[model samples]
Target: MKYTTMEQLLLTELVGAQVINHGGIKVCLRRSENIPSMGGATFDHVALFVLDGTVVEWIDHLNPWDIKSITSLKGSETNLYGSRGAYGTVLIETK
Candidate 1:
């Protein structure tokens, strides 16, 4: 399917403005909406991440093997983060 990402992720269900981090840590960008503003949005405006259940400001370093699963939430599904998930939310389950 056509896609976009902090890297790029693949999902048949991914819609317009949707994103996925298919390569490496970029996978955490899943569900990040594509909104090309005048100033452009930063990664923080792309998606909020939950690493091992702890909400982190950013992923400093991540080992592929440490990742157990990756889930993305968008639109109304992101209410849990308040405005943090306005773009989307990436839930990273690590080992």
Candidate 2:
């Protein structure tokens, strides 16, 4: 996997995204689209991807031991946790 760059995220407006804790991990959420198209989802997990550019805190949805990862959405292959047309969320935590 490739590490995300500050320029890519910042220029992409993926900063200050949100994240959710599932199975005790924090994962980055992305859009869900069968075809690679623009103007899709608002990114369900921006909070995790932009961690390198900024530090985020969702006290209500994370734990101290939580790790981080780019879990892709099933079928769609997008950087998300759950599946497309379903949850389309992810769970990454601190390793």
Candidate 3:
């Protein structure tokens, strides 16, 4: 999974974050705000997983304090099942 410069730009602008290339993907570590449903009422750091050219999920539920993981699949078919992006997908979890 390779993250393009354009994709990195989009991510930084969308989330005000920086990218770390790791495990064939761009990882973003961000600190977010309160989330009631997750038993989180304060700011906390979360991991953003991103796979370049892959599909991402759980976009709607992404918050400031959420940790996200993104990955891209090479030579793979698009699931298009529950993802939110055309290029790739993300997994959001509490830190």
Number of the top-ranking candidate, with TM-score as the measure: 1
- lDDT by residue (1-95, candidate 3, tens digit) is 33344345336544644343322324233333432223213222223334333335224333443333433321123255233233333443334
lDDT of 1 by residue, 1-95 (tens): 33343233323322343333323232223433443322333334556777887878655456444556667787798898888787677777866
Error of 2 at 86 (Å): 1.8
Error of 1 at 65 (Å): 1.1
Per-prediction backbone clash count:
4, 15, 21
Q: Answer with 1 or 2, whichever has the higher lDDT.
A: 1
Provide the global lDDT of candidate 2 against the true structure.
0.33
Write the number of the candidate with greater TM-score, choosing between 2 and 3.
3
Give candidate 1 regions above 4 Å deviation: 1-44
* Ten-residue stretch with the least lDDT total in model 2: 6-15
- lDDT per residue (tens digit) for residues 27-54 in model 2: 3434435323343333343333223233
Give candidate 1's error at residue 6 in angstroms. 10
Question: Least lDDT summed over 10 consecutive residues: which range in candidate 1?
Answer: 20-29
| Residue 64 shift from truth in candidate 2, angstroms | 6.5
Positional deviation of 53 in candidate 1, in angstroms? 1.7
Candidate 3 regions exceeding 4 Å error are 1-7, 32-95
Task: Please report the candidate that would top lDDT against the real structure.
Answer: 1
